[model samples]
Target: MANADARGRLRRPDGGPLRVLVVDDEPTLAELLTMALRYEGWEVRSAGDGLGAVRAARDFRPDAVVLDMMLPDIDGLEVLRRLRGDEPDVPVLFLTAKDSVEDRITGLTAGGDDYVTKPFSLEEVVARLRGLMRRAARSDTRPDSLLVVGDLVMDEDSHEVRRGGDEITLTATEFELLRFLMRNPRRVLSKAQILDRVWNYDFGGQANVVELYVSYLRKKIDAGRSPMIHTLRGAGYVLRPGD
Candidate 1:
């Protein structure tokens, strides 16, 4: 693949260089993505196959990855699954030609943090990458304070949830889902959107996974109390302040 550095224009919050990995079988597309990332002052690496991408990720240790769905050796979903198994919190953005709902859900469920369809605007790709990077940075700098909504309270640093002065226990996944909802109280979140944001994947195997988890959360957060998690039929779930 052809690689060249564009003039430096982007910088990290620490004023240091950002790093990115571009994994695509198409040489031209990979080069284009590399150029765009470089123009943002990010150190860019390119890999043309799934195996090569994995090796490159290990060697380059990028802060974010832009991966194409179709690759020569291994499928992108498999690649993403492997990557996530090794680094669950690593930010991955998928580039795909397949835009079907199932395709998007599969990509998301396979552990992609975000996805961009083919023939997409480079500006949107950059914006999505920036958002992923910002989110990753925020995850590392969580505040010590508690998040409160009505009678519910969650300790950010401790991963502790409580309601009406009673402690509640939740699985890691449930905690994350609840945290995301509480963070955006009253916002209408469709199941697909919840899967994308909270699960960091699209709804794949079971769209009901969101509903099941919502039930799990309710058992913990509101089993003997008034319901705060509302299910909007044909829509999704929302966390308000009361029953």
Candidate 2:
């Protein structure tokens, strides 16, 4: 909720410290998360119910939120839906005991950026939250700039792609997938990882979506250039700067 512009992109004006909201029915867990976030030098607040979570989010306007699935008043998914309705681009990390495939899918489809099952390591959660905040900060800073990889350039703000000065058209999903791949250049990403990171959903029965999107991206990003996005048999996909 914090750093929210008209377009829903997170921004921290005046270079203020990062702020985070922890929403969990368990007061101790909320406090623990709050403490962990604070250890990272972030300002944090906590809430114990859905309505309270919403209110706290509105007032605190955190850069990111760590929400639980089970709540007293409303469900976490509903809370996420409402949050997105108000600020679509707010970064959300679901920290819940709902570890089922369906639950993960529901959380992501509701607009959450990341999901961390309960009983998770505090270090991992903090690292993932930091990654999300970093990405959000980058998005705010370069809202309309072109992301470059070798001779391929993808203009995120303009939704345009060019290779060696030749413009390329891409579908919205293709663009998003490509941007994700480019942003993490050379990092091996499994289909599950790609689905979670790019599609923002669990690949319950939709693992092929990653392959489909990869093909779509290839047609646009590597049609006439060296193959930058490579698929490792039995592994996953990696986007390097060059072949």
Candidate 3:
């Protein structure tokens, strides 16, 4: 049964409990996660292996998933690949003991939405999950709000971007960052703010990843054209139409 905490309900935009699928082979950890999520008044389900995770994901149609990278059956990436085949937009938070930068990058580059290293604080996990779910809910409810700055336009509903009549393909993270920028055009955004909004402050205050992704975005959105994304030297980045 779903937990009924009137004050603690994790409600979706539709006023229903946010459904979460927790996938972990560690039985105790899985139960702990289930309990914690339930305590937030979220509808929670559990699966002990990759195959079961995929099956439960298909059946439950969860709004988000807390997935472990290690699994007994197929591995978490494979399970994620399978789950995404049905619902590509569902946010996924990866849980694992892999603490290396390469491991985190591998998970993110492999289409996982967020990565949480093991030996983590449950509060941090809950905060990250809440952020991801809020992002998803915002996109789902306001998909038609097309963001535009000069010749650049982003259709959040269709997940399409066009610049001066040229189409651009962006990864999910890139799209989200761009969307954030577009929503606040002409305003400089600090690395801290961007980290808080885009990366969820999970990087221990390191800003290199933010710079790296900004460079990545510049190459795609500004290369061979008048740049719309500008670095403000010791300040932050801003999106503005070139004069």
Per-candidate TM-scores read 0.67, 0.65, 0.82
Tens-place lDDT per residue, model 1, 1-243, is: 112225433445556677898999989988888898888778999999999988888888778889888888898898887777676667888887845555655676555666777888787788778767765665556779788999999997777888998888654456668888988899888888887776554466436557667766787787878889998898888889885
The ten-residue window of minimal lDDT in model 2 covers 1-10
Tens-digit lDDT track for model 2 on 1-243?
235456543346754667888889888888888888888667889899999988888888777889888898999998987776776667888876744656766665555666788788788788667657655655555666778988889887766788888988754345567888888888888898877766554566557557756776786677867888899988899998765
User: lDDT per model, in order?
Assistant: 0.76, 0.74, 0.81
User: Which is the winner by lDDT between candidate 1 and candidate 3?
Assistant: 3
Question: Which residue pairs collide in model 2, if any?
Answer: 2-61, 3-11
Model 3 Cα lDDT, one tens digit per residue, 1-243: 122236744576567788999999989988888888888778999999999998898889898899988888898889888988999878888887845666566666676777778887778778888877766655566637678899999998888999998999776667788998998999999888887888666546447657767877898899999999999988899999855
- Give me the displacement of residue 132 in model 2, in angstroms: 0.2
Predict model 2's lDDT versus the native.
0.74
Q: Which one wins on lDDT?
A: 3
Is candidate 2 or 3 superior in lDDT? 3
| Model 3 lDDT, residue 208, Cα | 65
In model 2, the Cα lDDT at residue 161 comes to: 85
- The clash numbers for all candidates, in the given order, read 2, 2, 0
